[model samples]
Target chain A: MADPAGAPCVEVVDLHKRFGALEVLRGVSFAVDRGSVVSIIGASGSGKSTLLRCINYLEQPTSGEVRIDGEPIGIERRADGSERRRSMREIGRFRRDLGMVFQQFNLWPHLTVLGNVVEAPIRVRGLPRRQAMELARACLERVQLSEKSSEYPARLSGGQQQRVAIARALAMQPKVMLFDEATSSLDPELTGEVLEVMRGLAVDGTTMIVVTHEMGFAREVSDRVIFLHGGLIEEEGPPAQVFGTPRSERCRQFLAKLLH
Target chain B: MGNWERLVWNQRNVLLDGFLVTLEICAIAFAVAVAAGLGLALLRLYVRPLRWPAIMWIEYCRATPIYVQLMWVNYVWPEILGWPTTFYTAGWVALALQSSGYLAETFRTGIENIGRGQREAAYAVGMSPLLTFRRIILPQVLVTIAPSIVTQFTVIVKSSTLVSVITVQDLMFQSQRLVNVWFEPIEILTATAAIYILFIFAVSAAGKALADRLRLRYGLGT
Candidate 1:
């Protein structure tokens, strides 16, 4: 379903976002090539989550562009130099191509694990109930939660619930998966299990953009790392280079504060 | 004891018939209240253009006393709207109007109490707003507000007695008729009061059980 053969899986150019008087993202730009993993690392309030959200149009950008597989989303520009915000129907269709995982898990508590995974595929994708259930089972198997598919989210442990959330996203078969601090809300011990599933996805060459506080996972698993500072990219490069010898003093200090 | 047997027991068939009418009116009123309440609450919360009108209607229904509304609907509405042209129709309409307002507020509170994250999660998966509300939002709201909904129904049952003023021939109407016939208010009215207390007690108890069962089955209950 990925039609653009050479176009980047996800791209953002000169993105800016403001919440009232607070500017959360300022002129952020980057691209993730197909089948590559890029991790975004930043301090709290540095706009890492906001940047990820804008990429999927969850947080609308005040200005600039986000394109998925070379097609612009959220806002469309016309020849007359005016912008039209895309209709909810249009945006909703575009969002089907991207999967997003939240820090809160956000699983529908009323639904069993299988129900949560199959709901969108059946409702949004218009997949047959049988096909959706089959897809849901496969996704649950990938997360190693097939046994828990019949259970409600509240009955699951934190790690287990997050895994179900991942499976829920995976069922979409999205072109690029976005993780917005996906493991941040878990217990320290539980974070590892969720991170392990993410690492497996990276190994399987799923195109991904992860916003994280987990430095070890980011450094070891990511092909590239972008460190955000006050709504701007302070430094970005291969994880090895950014972590080993950062260019900016802020990057150096941030890494030092985290690593030690 | 003789009066109890004569006025209360001997008049069992009349009282029973009136009780059935009470049940019928309450059932119709409660059904309308649920459906209309949900519609009004959604309009108030989601439809920007209709929000103020929905709010005014809900407030009007709530602020007026039930008896006054009953009288107004029974007397004035026919002149103004030329509908609900019978005593029975007016009785249920007035009852439903009153409860619909309270239930609308209940539904709004339930919908608002849901976490924003739930809707965002549904949207993130590509579900449209309507789909999200139907499949995700409404189910959770129903479970969370089930107890309050049951309470509202009891309130409706209790308030249904006032319909007798319009000659609706409900339980209260029959008991009053018997009082006029025997010219004895003590025996029959006491029996009527006791019957109402017991009937309401049973309805609420059953409703509570059903709500609890729903919560245990679908909610995050342990």
Candidate 2:
């Protein structure tokens, strides 16, 4: 087993992001230990999604830095003050270790289910077509979707599509996975199916960072849970410490509303 | 009776010849327009330095009337440069450019309409922008933009009629010759209009069938 404390898998320091006049994230700082699950529980508009986006450099931070396994994810300014953004190719190479599953399940409609799973592996990683297809088949099997591999994304239910999205990401063989409210857009029965897959991943020690409103899932799956409110991390600890014992009035009030 | 037989014989061959010429011009010009339009759209989307220039070029071509553009390219560029290019080549070049402007905008819109999440999803999967665009974006764009492109192609076919002014003996030019000889203005003009309408109708039907097949195959409509 890898030592958990030696080196963090991801680190964000003093992260700040603003959209025009709207300040979304302010001085956010956190780090995720390897092989652990961290759940970010936040109300809507609390910058949780933006925080996930910032991790992979999908959304550029206004001012701050993120390091994924010690690899810088954002732009750097030179001595002459010329700002240099990473080329798309560089970003693609860096992003190979990081997979993000979206709430909307953003699966490519033009591709069949198997094609979606195999696309990145074959195109970006230059995997052999047969090898990529084999990997894709394995991922679909993991998601319990191998039978539906021939179907297109549109033919699947919301839950099934989200699972396919997860399989697509898994086909890349990522070291870390980010779930931005992966079940938020799903109906209850559909949400249950996706949560089951996530739970299975956690048991297998897949390092994951998830943003979700499913408190029950938070209680069940997370090793650590952080509540983000008003563009800042309000409280964080082990799930029991944060959920069982109340410390802040804000947390209490937030819990009360959620419980009701 | 022999006069009627001769009229039928003469008109069918003449119209067939005219149809072949019209198809030839449309095929060449449409290929040029699609290639140029896709190149311009990619430049605009990916190269920051070229974005404004690409937009300006598309706008300039789009804003100018096609007839004026044809006339200018047909008469002016060759005269100014002292090039010995043929009128047929000049006419096709002008039509290709004008059509490219519109097609570029169509491609750009198709690219942009793909949600930001789709790009983020692609990036998160470790696919490079080129791979993402080629495998993911361009395929979707084809499905999304095909209808508009076919519509524009139909328009391009009709617009090929403008080549008559540049000395290309296309359908409308043949119709004019027939009118001048027979002195039946309304009949010849109506016949030309009917032919064009039939071509447009056929193209639209083909486009619809293709779109439906794509939707069924890809499940995009769902």
lDDT of 1 at A13: 94
Which runs in model 2 stand beyond 4 Å of their true positions?
A1-5, A75-85, B1-4, B43-52, B82-84, B181-192, B216-222
What would the DockQ be for model 1? 0.71
TM per prediction: 0.96, 0.91
- Worst-scoring 10-residue span by lDDT in model 1 chain A: A1-10
Residue-by-residue lDDT tens digits, candidate 1, A9-91: 88999999999999999899999998999999989999999998888888889998999888789877789999888998889
- Quote model 1's TM-score: 0.96
Question: Model 2, B105-190: lDDT tens per residue?
Answer: 99999999888888888888877777778888888889978888998899789888989888788888887888788776666677
Clashes of 1: 0
- Residues A1-260 of candidate 2: C-alpha lDDT, one tens digit per residue: 34344557888888999999999999888888888999998779999999999888888889888877755676655789787777767777878888889999999988889999998899888899999999999999999999999998888999999999999989998878999999999998789999999999999989899999999999899999988887788899989988888576677788889999
